[model samples]
Target: MNNNIKRTLTTTILAAAFTVQAGENNFDQAYNSVSEADLRSHVKTLASDEFEGRQPTTIGEEKTLDYLTRQFTALGYQPGNNGSFLQPVELVRIEADPNVTLQIGDDSFEYKQNMVIGTSREQESVSLKDSELVFVGYGVNAPEYGWNDYAGVDVKGKTAVILVNDPGFANPDSGKFQGKTMTYYGRWTYKYEEASRQGAAGALIIHETAPASYGWSVVANSWSGPQYHLVTANGNKDRVAVEGWLSVEAAQTVFQKAGLDFEKLKEQAKNGPTAKAMSVKASVTVKSSLKRSKSNNFIATLPGSKAPDEHIIYTGHWDHLGKDPSKKGDNIYNGAHDNATGTASLISMAKAFASLKQRPARSVSFLIVTAEEQGLLGSKYYAEHPVYPLNKTVANLNLDAMNILGRTKDVAVVGFGKSELETYLTKAAKRQGRIITQEDRPEAGYYYRSDHFSFAKKGVPALYAEGGAESADEESAKYRKKMKVILNGCYHQVCDEYRDSWDFGGIIEDTQMFFEVGYDLANSDDWPKWNKTSEFQRPE
Candidate 1:
């Protein structure tokens, strides 16, 4: 065998041996340290009315940081960020005026109803006046996929109207673009990014329920409020002046006004690039109020006994939607299931690791980030300016929106089959009498929507798993139906409050399994690898 191959084999064997030895050691005490009662208490406090929904740059952020700091200090964890628990993330908040209307030729679309628009640029006003409209199918420029929507078009000073989701979404069985599984290219974030790269002055995505995954309510609620992005030296001038979404109805009206058939174009888009210029021109002006502030990413670490430089990271976002005074009855978002549960899980996990009889060979870090509701701003900033060198970072295990339903016979691994971390998770789950399963909805792009994605983009292995669809008890079908209702109704709404009747059985099981996986990685020299089929690869 070649020297490199032989060395790799030896390392793998040694790591496996270390894992087996570590598995044999007694971890019952540490494993049992995570209690349902403790988790409930943390979630209750964080999601309470006094917390004001835990929005960053508000009073809510201050309270959340203080609470997390105390919990970590009590658990005997040292600050992971250079003797300080807080890593300052500079952010720019922009709230667009509500009265703005998007004009497409003679049709005018109102904000939050027919359309919603905003800008990432750090300015008071951004305007696109009488710019030509170009239909750039999927707005994708993937060379590997042999697709370039703007191949021969000059959208430099025009507005690019794009479609939501990827090409494979419409025909999952056609063997195109991962087949029903949404890729990074399918995300709305990518659509805006690609448009900016094409030098488009504005980008507007047509939203369809099936393709976009969520309903128009989700889009309206999320985009209407204040927007936040990491502060940049150039004020994000490279980005399009305006980024927005159009309801399916509004898109059709605009297309008809331009003497085109929207449905036919959508079909042509599915096959390949359909970059066509429309006869209509686009005009919109966004006047925004800007606020510059600093949010904190709270980090605490348990030092490794052997290799302190190597790290295993646990991440959870602490920020939520914050209170909206414009509403009458309930103003607070109280994101209990959305993320309070995940934030609390970080504390529970930290407690479990602290109770260990012997420290693991590698370090474990708990990172509670801010501004997740505002498009993962906190995590994105951390990824770009990492507290620890990305190379030394072992893996990122993210906790978000934990299951409040009863225990399940299986665990749902989001973005499954992407990494070898699943091997470790599967082994740990089997011991708990549970199996690992793929996420029920792969087209939602859940993997790219969380904090773990930040680490994943940097080529570090990441895992995002939660309670599964199959219940442990006899009422499996009934349990699944109930979960569906809750997930669909409460997501990003004021109704997502903490409930007294929530069952913590599933969360406990999932949390315990997470502990086992992280414990194994911490005690071994194993470097989990991404699957060859995965689009991400570790940088050489």
Candidate 2:
């Protein structure tokens, strides 16, 4: 090779790299088009008191669905569900009468005071009278981990008293049940499902503030309302007659009455592989009225220019705790940060994609689902009856309550290391001069608490990215402290309303990074795959 020829080739390669970098700046223009003013406007409107907290099966649903449909149409995207933007989801709203009670041996626990109970069964009335109670350490039966909390005890027709989170959470050993990082077994949803599969008549989870990741008020506020669940063809026949949570005080009382040391039992449960289930002297009566209603899951799509059959989903739940008129001053649980931010981002991102000079090769869909505050019902229905086949759906990027704390030096990938989508996320984050990491509070099982889990359960790879702890400014220490305060204090509370204190700089940056990740994936032919050992990789 001649020196002149080699120099010419090197110069050409450098020139192209510069050109690509310059082209990236053009893409940034599209990304930066997601203005903070737009995000704030959308959030303020959706989270306003007028929406009645955005609850499904109420006036809130009408306002929310209408707003999303209008925004999607304005963005020039087509309806995702066939030719209609609305995907009708039939749901049963069940509210347990305040007359519920639980009796553990000689101790009596009153409803909403010591404990709360509800049923998944679609019935006008449901009850579990004189149902025996059994202490199931964690109520998990994982064959992969070779651990079974319900091994020796049979809970059929009995009430299974379970612990929140999992044994690995309390124990420090990484090799034991994935250590502190909560898995499917640690999720409350998984606990109830296991109880039902075991033919248990009822399931009650003991709530400790730290392990449960929220206070008793949160538990009460979240579970006490009209719980919404998709109306299954089987009528939730396999479900337990009752499922609820017992306050720590209530649990202590039950343990004392049963002649068991509460702290000692907790220690045994934490020391996994040795904990055992035993029968307790207790019973429960659960009664609830079930009313059927329908909610619309707003879905819109930017069809692929090339591979129209393939899909990339973007999900954000639009539901929040409705107006609590019982409160004295502020009654509405305006979930501004809880989800209005994410929902607004959905509109902003959709608009950005529509502004692209050319559509990506793979289709991208925006799903603003309902009843997430109640449960992931809207997404669950979509997963069961998808507009696009699960096998063909490439990946899901879920936005839920994005940080309004300003841009940070890192992005938190909730349930990180579970899929190849993180590879894309890491690259996109790096391009924005940020790092990628995992959720700081993995034990909370935040991964299973959102809409993305619906898609992941159906074997599609999902990504949930959020702002990380490393604040980009000098207020780093203050930012981290404030982060804890918000999650502990305002999260899921009436205080979660939109505040002028929020610095939308970070939200906009994270939004752009999310858009880029989806943009890259939609343009590529590659199908993201779950990591080999991912618990959700198994196809349904």
Candidate 3:
């Protein structure tokens, strides 16, 4: 063997020997190191008024990254990005003129009222004038599931009006499309991506509060702010020229104008093979102005002893809505649950790993990203421009809006059956005298709403687990009702600040659970893979 090959082989052998020598699992010590006090301290700082809501491309980002880097350094972690803790992500922010309106034949859709639209493409100017519109049902084309909403339609150079969520959602059938649970196909991101793949000039997802989960106000607020997209080499030429959402009422108006029954078509769309494409006899117009900026993805590494080349990643987005100046009173969206809690968990997890007596066989990385509130952009960038080969990545465990509802009898694994990581989570939770359950409200599409998805799309097994229904000491019904109130009242609003009433016990439990899962993956020879039937499974 050549000198370099000999050196690599010797190192691997030596590391394996070291792993064998370290018989006792030091994970308990590490898990114990993940303390509630530490987690709360970190979250308090991250979500404080001083951090200015941790928004990307602002002083808030600077403060957040500095805090993360400092904490990782204190935990004895090395810079993950080639000796640098920060990964530079180029992005373009587009602020659409609020006055922009969409004319669908005689029916007009007003911005932020009837509809919301923006383009992912990075251009000085973008416009679509009198583009032909086609109702393409769910807009999904999943061959594995034997479903295709755009099968008979040619949507190229025209606008495709699609429905949010999967067809199985509105009308459930166990025989088709994962039943009521939202698949990756149900995500709004998928709708846009599938539209782009079909060569559509534009895509508009018709939003219903039930199917879409969140209220119309969510779509309005999320899409209204400065929209962000990764800076593309071809200036996002691959993406649709226009991408957006239309209110249910507005969508019904378009269908009525086209001499079609919106309700009847929706039912048809849910039934397999009955869904057909129809010309809406309508058109749309949109224009946007672009702004460009740079964001940083803070990456820190705890190198392994045996297989340093392989990795188990812990990821969380650090960005939120920032400060809205228009609001008269408190305008800072602290995002204490939306993700400050999740971001802080990264530090606690890092501390736990660093406290270990012996490092795991594989490395662990803390990927604290930005622009999650702006459509998971930072994680998307990291997935595209990874510091390590994606094939070498064993798994990603993501935390978002951590459990503030106290300890629970079970942990909910979002996208539960997608990977073997869920099995590992179940084992860990079982040790804590807790069971594992799939997300109760699968219709919300929680799996696709977080950062782990960015890695999952690239074939890395990712875990997104949370405290499930039935808090240990509270009645399940009362617990769920209160949780719903929080989700409705505080989520993405200025009110998502750190509160004294919030329980960190469940957060602590879940954080340690994540630590244990990562520890198992990093040390074991087993490489977790997506389920055989999973769309995210690696091509063999």
Candidate 4:
């Protein structure tokens, strides 16, 4: 081998040997070294009244990005994007018309209670003039599964109303669908995109608090305010004419009036194929207002010694609800658990990675993405416009929220079986004398909710690491019950704030574990591939 080739080979083999020994390092000591007090200090500061909840396109954005940039610099990480830490993700913000109305043959859809609607188009007003409507089952067009909800249908200029959740539930015992695991078919975004592909003028997904696993209020609270989308030419024209959700009750009423059985269709949609799409034998119309705005994504990197071209990434979002001074007691949606915790912990991780005695073989990029609360906009932009190639990029370790119920004896990964990342995670946890927990509610579609989904969609293996289901010193039964109750209650509410008495012990455990997941990947040559069953994994 030439000297250069021989040198590269030497480095690769040395990295392999070092990783074997590094894997056995004291993971618990690393976990303990992460200061919970320091982490909470950052969280408290970001979620504090001074930052005004860190909303995008406001002074809060300035403060949030400034603090994050300072943290990464203090941690000794080099700037990630061309010697700068911030990647400006241009977005068009849309605020719905309070007087918005959807009418289908004299029947007006209820706002807030029935459905939430908005447009990303750059127009003062938008309307759907005499477009027909159809029910396209779950609205999924996955070819690998031999399923097409749009079979035998010309939905162009027509609205396709799809059912929510996975087809597995449609035919419970048929073994066609995933039974309980919510496939990508269940996501609302999928319904809209499928409709767009079908050239549909509009797409409406039926939402139930149960199958959706979150209350209608969660949908309302998120959609009521501002919605952000990547700024693209043709005004994101490839997207559907419009996208919205209908409440379960509203959908039942409309389906019944149209001589269709809402319950039966829902069940049928869950099964393989519904054969025919819901016929638009009816017409519908809607009118709305739109807004344009801008946001920013914060980024930093721990440079590698040998392979700077290859990368490993750690991601979190910095934006939240901002100051909703309209509410009483606490008008600010501080987003303590929603993401401030995740962002703060990332700051901790960047520091830990920077402090290592040895530089990694691959570059470690620490990214604080923007507008995740608005629907993973910033990370989506980064994936589309990455500083590094997605293929050479080994893995993405994404954090949004960390459980603050103190330290647990276990760690929970949302999509545990979907990729080889889990094996490395299991090893890391075992090294810390902790265990890994699979998703507690796989049927609810937790895996597809965060910014990680964007990376997953791009065929880059990613992990959504969070607290384990089991609590320390608590009985399994009590832990399960308590866990379920808490997730349901505080999922997306004003109540998701900083708590003084929180035992950040669990947060530290998870952060340290997350640190190693990236550390090991950054130091090694092998890249984790998606599992065989995972739909996102591209064919060989």
| Best model number under lDDT | 1
Q: RMSD, model 1, all Cα superposed?
A: 3.2
Q: What is the C-alpha RMSD of each candidate to the true structure, in Å?
A: 3.2, 4.9, 6.3, 5.4
Best by TM-score: 1
What lDDT does candidate 3 reach at residue 485?
Answer: 77
TM-score for all models, in order of appearance:
0.95, 0.93, 0.91, 0.89
Who is ahead in lDDT, 1 or 2? 1
- What ranking of all candidate models by TM-score puts the best one first? 1, 2, 3, 4
lDDT of 2 by residue, 329-351 (tens): 98888899879999989899888
Give the per-residue lDDT digits (tens) of candidate 1, residues 70-152: 99999999998999999999999999999899999998999999899999999899999999999998999889988888899
Clashes of each: 0, 2, 0, 9
Residue-by-residue lDDT tens digits, candidate 3, 1-540:
763455346445543543453347575677788887898898899899999988788889999888888888888999999899999988888877777778777777888898998888876556677678888889989988898888877888888889899977877755678778888899998989999999999999998989988888888877886788888779888999889999999988888777789988888888863344455544544556787899999899999899999999899999998887766899898888888899888899888888888788899998988888887898999998999889898899999999888788999989877877766686578668898888898878888899999998888888999998777775544655676677666777788898765668889999988887787778778887787667788645
Q: In model 1, where is the ten-residue run with the lowest total lDDT?
A: 3-12
Ranking by lDDT: 1, 2, 3, 4
lDDT, each prediction: 0.89, 0.83, 0.83, 0.76
Model 4 regions more than 4 Å off: 1-20, 23-31, 275-291, 325-329, 475-488, 538-540
| Cα misplacement distance, residue 236 of candidate 4 (Å) | 2.1
lDDT of 4 by residue, 58-128 (tens): 88999998898788778887788897887888888776665667776557876686888766565556667
- Pairing residues by index, what is the TM-score of model 2? 0.93
